[model samples]
Target chain A: MIENAKVCLYPKNPGEVVRILEQEGRRALILAGGTTASQVRDPGVTTLVDITRMAPPTDALTHEDGEWFLGCNLRIQQLAAHAGLKQVFCGMLCDAALSVGSRPIRNAVTLGGNAVSVFRWSDPPVALLAMDASFDLVGPERERTLTADRFYSRHPRRILKPAEILKRIRVGVPSGRHGGAFFKFARTAFDLAVVDVAVCLWFDSDICSRARVAIGATRNVPWLSTRAARMLVGKRLEGKSIRAAARAAREETKTADDIRTGREYREQMVEVIVRRTIERAGDNALGV
Target chain B: MDIHVNINGQAVAWRANPGENLLDVLRREGFASVKRGCNQGDCGACTILVDGTAQRACLLLAGQAEGRSLVTVEALGTPAEPHVLQQAVVEHGAVQCGFCTPGMLLSAKALLDENPSPTYADVCAALDGNLCRCTGYKKIIEAVLDASGRLRK
Candidate 1:
């Protein structure tokens, strides 16, 4: 239904993508995977800048100086199969990748698009927030890096200015005894998450040294409950600590009634999901 | 605009609107095997092999597919000479309405091309996007597994 669009501009690189973004400004829509963009009938978009053509070489996963650099266009299937990612951030990255849509959808969806498109139930953004991933932004005026949490703070729309494109995402490899798990609660495997949770816990022997807990589909944005995460620090991930953190998560989340589920139901499920995810993360940390 | 792509190994030219997708363009070219169940990507009835990878044609703009090799269910085998997978699908009684067959066959073809041997779980996961309302999926999975065994022999 995206009729009368002027052209689907093919940019060669991030700089060219930025230049096109600058030229068209808000009148242009950047097409990454086109899963969401293609279906839109945006009367405002005169041009569709197809950024998939500007993709880096197919082998886009690279490790440099301990940080994992992923091309913005790397398909979800590629990200899921990435050996290095499987080795380090196994459960969190792969599980989120596998959670998105289905096989053909994953073949077409990109990790960057999943995060940058501001889909509330997007699996990767929540997992990336838990992983503390940062994005590389290239703009006509400036280039910068922002943490996953900051990049998604605006919720429904990406924080990128009209002339900026997310070039890549850089993830710092987590050190120490850390375990992460991503869970999506959907009616079926192909359905979008009614609610999802991601937990990354760092433990020093029996004590929890650090924690990151994120929840999606229950708020305007997928949120990293920093307060809840902080509550788990310097404590063992036992029943008492988990209950406190789960209570904090439910308290902090902003939920609303929607067609799929009710506000109270989501709020109630938040406590349950958080408690279970934290316990699963604890088990993962112990290699159990 | 005019875009040229190698569809089913033949270079072809077609006129497309700026907003037209590969699904529209292919259907115009008489590749009816590329069915259009959902213009949106949710339904994989329009699935086709783009560079040996199964991708939804609805999600790909005709311009995005330019200069790339496109494969459709038409390339697999004709009715007179059915592909191994197509034959297996018939033998397993997978086709009920038959609307989801092309996409299912292409998805299974992509998987078997990469992994000649796949577990039942892998077969199910590969065809997850292609929905079949008729056979309830078990027969489709069995067909793919049966085809895999046949391809090996």
Candidate 2:
């Protein structure tokens, strides 16, 4: 659909994405995964550099004491398939990856791209946010680390500059009593989410010590329901706490009248999904 | 852009648009077997094996296919001496109207390459992305499983 656009395939690395951006001097588009980028109309665009190989490093998944490192280039598919990471998170990442489009889409769409682009329907942002994920960033102003919350500062409006390149995504993998789960509701088998909920529970026995409930597809970034998480910290997740947390999650979001679902219906569905996912994550603590 | 790609075991060159999907480019170059049904990536009628992995040719940019080994329906043996999968499909009566056969074949080929013995569930999972308006997709699933069994032997 785009005219006068030239694509440069086989970018050697992610840095090349930055270099070409610099060389093109803001006139061209730096395209990685070309899913949404190709669809847009950028009049100044003359070149489109494909960034499939420009993915970040997959060098380490080490654990020192408690901190865990997840490589940025780790494809959403790759993250789902890693047996070690899956064992720790218990299908949290896998659920997110499986929730996206079909096989070929998953095969090419990287985790970093999903996060950097920050589409609300995208899974990584909500799942990673629930687990307290951080990013190792590389930019013109030297390299630094930014938490998922800080990395996504625009609450209701999701937008990012072209110059920022995400190097790696880091998370403190849940250990001991922590467990996580993600649930997405779409119109059909493969479609964007209307409303989704992800839960990460740190329960020592039946008593929940800490918890995080993130609502997705209803907000710009993953809306971490601190009130919902707090309501469950001291109580059990089975009965009253579930109802209260679900209520808090509902109050935290303000949905619009989209074709997917009505504003009232989405708010109601959010409560339902939150309660269900939280209970499901809590059930995992029993290992039953 | 001028690009060279290995098409069905032979190197074929084309002066292509980098933004163009590989499906149109391949079809233009007379690989008639690579069906073009859906311009969108959903329908698997344009599926092809790129670097031994099944991918939607409609979704991939022509420039992205460079340096990759591309296998399309043309590579499979003809009706006179059909590939084992083609034979299985015909025997199982999997082709009806048959707009979706080429992509189905590539999906089957990619799965068989990865798993010589795939269960019925595995076959369904591999072909989930590929859609068919005819044959009810029942016989096609059976054909893939049947081919998997034959290849395993």
Candidate 3:
């Protein structure tokens, strides 16, 4: 229960939001999408500033050559409906958006707020990390864009400051024959991932040319299996290499025990999900 | 302090206190359709459309809803003249114990509004957040599809 809380509805403007926060100082909690209740674990959160009514970006999704610019308010559901965005990210947004809690949660949920929360049991961070996505973060200082990968490194421990606004996320369309799939396994179907695996596999015929697999819900931040990915880099999509990579992934998993599952078991499940997701991805890549 | 919000289409002032969620505030103001099931966002029982998008009112502060158009279960058609989605559910015999019906209907409405022609998977995705213990929810899925077809014209 919140105490001495106040609900302040400032108009939807970036400068206004910043100004209000600056004025309120530590008393204000900028609530966007209302989806952060699951993400934020603050007991002292009493006052809320609804940032939902903020005006949409006064711009279009300008595609200069190949690169496209998506606004912060460009919701994941809208992104799924968009024909252009569907083909580029290879159904990552649709997959991520569908699995986030429920329909009502997704409806109000924004793409920007997800990254800002920086929870392990999130989908966008893993999906964005896989597709080389970056965010156009607007803060009190100025506007700057940082790679989502860099964003993860910057805040390896916890979330970034509230003043730093996660403006817009930019995802580069995948080039060449890249096959990817994200499979998350949890105790309850809707619960947080016991172990979530996202595999982006590049293939040269049946053999893997390159692969970037990022696993979340296992550690503080996402655990990128660089060693495991290296094991499968040049090897044929056959028996020994797959098991070896799975082993390395299991060994690397530092999943702490929680109410849902044990650490040792979660580590084993990571191997199982990694093997299965990679196998499915490999099959799709091989057209088998 | 009081907040000005547009509930459904009409603008109304909500005397929301601190710690009062939009769901509770709506109930206090005599809009009792917004069910308080789990208090957590996991249950879709407290679902409503904030700015035409389905969201868990339980999680949203009344302040966040200020200035935005909110569509509770009341916003949809009534028993005498039900909305298309409501009519579809009735026609399909989708109401069982009917605890999750309001949320389910709102979820369907949000889905149909967002995507007029969603596939079967889209319908399932729309109902992901809502849980009905008594009913199997298969009929609800059919009802949403039926509503989608009816709304297509």
> Top model by lDDT, which number?
1
Error of 3 at A181 (Å): 1.9
lDDT of each: 0.84, 0.76, 0.74
Q: Tell me how far the alpha carbon of residue A4 in candidate 1 is from the true structure, in angstroms, after superposition.
A: 1.2
lDDT of 3 by residue, A1-288 (tens): 344565565657776777776667667776766666433445566667666556776123445566667666555565545667656545655576556666566666676666666577877667677666777776677878877677776442243455656656777766666677777787776788777777778877666889877787887667578777988998787778878888888988777887778888988998998888777667756766
Clashing pairs in 1: none
TM-score of each: 0.96, 0.92, 0.87
lDDT, candidate 3, residue A106? 64
Q: Which residue ranges in model 2 land beyond 4 Å of their true spot?
A: A7-9, A54-69, A155-162
Task: Tell me the tens digit of each residue's lDDT in model 3 across B6-54.
Answer: 8878898877664567778888888888898998898898888877888
Q: What C-alpha root-mean-square deviation, in Å, does candidate 3 show against the real structure? A: 3.2
Q: Which candidate leads in DockQ?
A: 1
Worst lDDT window (10 residues) for model 3 chain A?
Answer: A154-163
Q: Model 1 off-target regions past 4 Å?
A: A55-59, A156-158
State the lDDT of candidate 2 residue by residue for B54-148, as single tens digits. 77777676766677689988898887999999999999999998888988988899889989999898898888888899787899999999999
A130: Cα error in model 1, Å: 0.6
lDDT of 1 by residue, B95-142 (tens): 989998999999999999999999999998898898887889999999
Error of 3 at A58 (Å): 8.5
Going through the candidates in the order shown, the clash numbers are 0, 0, 2
